[model samples]
Each structure stands twice: as C-alpha cells, then as structure tokens.
Target: MERKKLTLLQTVFTAGVFSAVSFWYGFMFGRESARKELGGLIEDLRRGTAGSEPTPRSS
Candidate 1:
C-alpha cells in the first residue's frame, strides 16, 4: 500500500536526521575539550616563564 511506503520513508528520514545531529554534538564536545586542555597548557608555560625571570636592580 502507498501508506506503508510513506511510513517507511518517514522513518528512514527521521533516523538520518537524528544521526547527523548526534554526530555534530559529539564533534563539538571533543573540540571544546581540546581547546580547554590547550589553554591550560599555555597558561602553565606562562607561569613557569614568569617564575624563572630575574629581577632588575636599580642604582
């Protein structure tokens, strides 16, 4: 019947849409975690450099 075919098509379309959205969310999550880790590493380097510097003496 035509109704059965239409139902099957709708089901397939819904599944595809859900899969695409899920993939997008997972990608965003991974990107954000990487950004945070890199930022933390840069901050640590800055702190280390600052601590190792010698102070200037004025006459």
Candidate 2:
C-alpha cells in the first residue's frame, strides 16, 4: 500500500510539471507571434500604406 501511494504521488507531480512547462512555452510563442505582427503593422503605418483604402487628400 505504501509503495503504491508513493508511485501515484510521483506520477501526479510529474504530470503537473509537464503541464506547467507546456503552458509556459505556449505563452512565450504566442507573445513572440504578436510582437512580430505588431512590428509589421507599425512599419506599414510609417510607410503611409496601412490598408487598401487610400488616404483622402485635403486641399
């Protein structure tokens, strides 16, 4: 009974650790992707071509 309990505890601990690590990795990847997308948008705005619609000319 003692050995079985210890094994169960160890298995749960390992699974928790694995879940935490995977979550961290996914968060980091999502952040990096957003950063890259934002950079591209900024560059487009700077170039005066943010979207397909043309900017209106004001006389």
Candidate 3:
C-alpha cells in the first residue's frame, strides 16, 4: 500500500537527519573543548614569559 511506503520513507528520513545532527553536535563540542585547552596553554605561556623577564627602565 501507498501508506506503508510513505511510513517507511518517513522513518528513513528521520533516522538520517538524526544521525547528521548528532555528528555535527559532536564535532562542535570537540572543537570548543580544544579551543579552551589551547587558550589556557597560551595564557600560561604568556604568564611564564612575563614572570621570567627583567623589569627596569629607570634613568
């Protein structure tokens, strides 16, 4: 019957959509985590460099 075919098509489309959305969200979260980690590392390095520098420009 036509109704059965329509139901099957709808189920397949929904599954495909859910899979794509899940993949996209996972990738997005991973990138956000990586960005935070890198940002923290850069800040730490900057602090370390500043700490090791000499201070004195008085004449």
Candidate 4:
C-alpha cells in the first residue's frame, strides 16, 4: 500500500510539473508571437502603409 501511494504521488507530481512547463512554454511563445505581430503593425503604421489596405467590415 505504501509503495502504491508513493507511485501515485510521483506520477501526479510529474504530470503537474509537465503541465506547468508546457503552459509556460505556450504562454511565452504566444507572447513573442504577439510582440512580433504588433511590432510589424507599428512599423507599418509609422510608414503610413497601415491604412493603404481596406479593412473588411464585419456585419
């Protein structure tokens, strides 16, 4: 019984650690992607090219 409990605890801990690491990696990747996109948008705005394309209106 003790061994089973220890195994279960270890498994849960490992899963939790993996989940946290995956979440952190995903969050960092998303943030970097957003930063890059925003940087491009800012540059386009600064160059006055942002308004050259017509934006689609959502009904």
Candidate 5:
C-alpha cells in the first residue's frame, strides 16, 4: 500500500539522517590533533582541550 511505502521511506530517511549526524560529529570531534596542539606553544596555552576540568587546589 501507499501508506506502507511512505512509512518505509520515512524510516529510511530517519536512518540516513542519524547516520550522517553521527558521522559528522565523529569526524569533527574524533581527532587527537583536532582536540590538542601538535607540539610547542602548548605550555604557553595550558588550556588542555575542551570539557576539561581543572585540578583541585589545596589550601
């Protein structure tokens, strides 16, 4: 039926969208150098990538 075909098409579209989004996110945030400096100047920056927590300071 047409309804069944439409449901199948929607399912495929949803799957494709999910796949593309996962691939894009992985490609964007999955590289070491993309998240970190190659070398040198690292000491100067000391930021240490995104979502990093700072060390606790002791009194």
Candidate 6:
C-alpha cells in the first residue's frame, strides 16, 4: 500500500514538472507578431503578391 502511494505521488510530481517546462518552452519560442507576419507573407506569396500593395480594381 505504501509503495503504491509513493508511486502515485511521484507520477503526479513528474507530470506537474513536465507541464511547467512545456508551457515555458512554448512561451519562450512563440512570438505572436512574428508568427502573424510570417502567416501574412505566406498568404501574399500564395496570392502572387510578393511586395507591392494591392490596388483596387474597378469594373
């Protein structure tokens, strides 16, 4: 019984530590503005617009 309780406690502690480290790693590497800019660049490339601004097209 005591061994089982110890094993459960160890598992809980390990999980908590792992979660904290994962969260910190993601926060440190994830830059919101940079990600947004990269996404926009990708979209522009897909649309065949690399640099210039899009002008309005009148019918």
Top of the candidates by TM-score: 4
Backbone clash numbers for all candidates listed: 0, 0, 0, 0, 0, 0
Each model's lDDT? 0.80, 0.84, 0.80, 0.84, 0.66, 0.80
lDDT of 1 by residue, 1-59 (tens): 99999999999999999999999999999998888777766776877854555444322
Deviation in Å, model 2, residue 59 alpha carbon: 41
Model 1 lDDT, residue 43, Cα: 71
TM-score for each model: 0.74, 0.84, 0.71, 0.87, 0.56, 0.54
Candidates ranked by TM-score:
4, 2, 1, 3, 5, 6
Cα lDDT tens digits, model 5, 1-59, are: 99999999999999999999999888877564444543323543566543455433322
Single out the weakest 10-residue window by summed lDDT for candidate 5: 50-59
How many Å off is the CA of 32 in candidate 1? 0.6
lDDT of 6 at 17: 100
TM-score of model 5 (CA atoms): 0.56
Candidate 2 per-residue C-alpha lDDT over 1-59 given as tens digits, one digit per residue, 9 for 90 to 100: 99999999999999999999999999999998888777777777999898766544322
Across 1-59, the per-residue lDDT of candidate 4 in tens digits comes to 99999999999999999999999999999998888777777877888888688444322
**Residue pair clashes in candidate 6:** none
Model 1: pairs clashing at backbone N, Cα or C within 3 Å: none
**Candidate 6 on 1-59: residue-level lDDT in tens?**
99999999999999999999999888867776567667777877999998789544322
- What is candidate 6's TM-score against the reference? 0.54
Please give the RMSD of candidate 5 to the true structure: 8.3
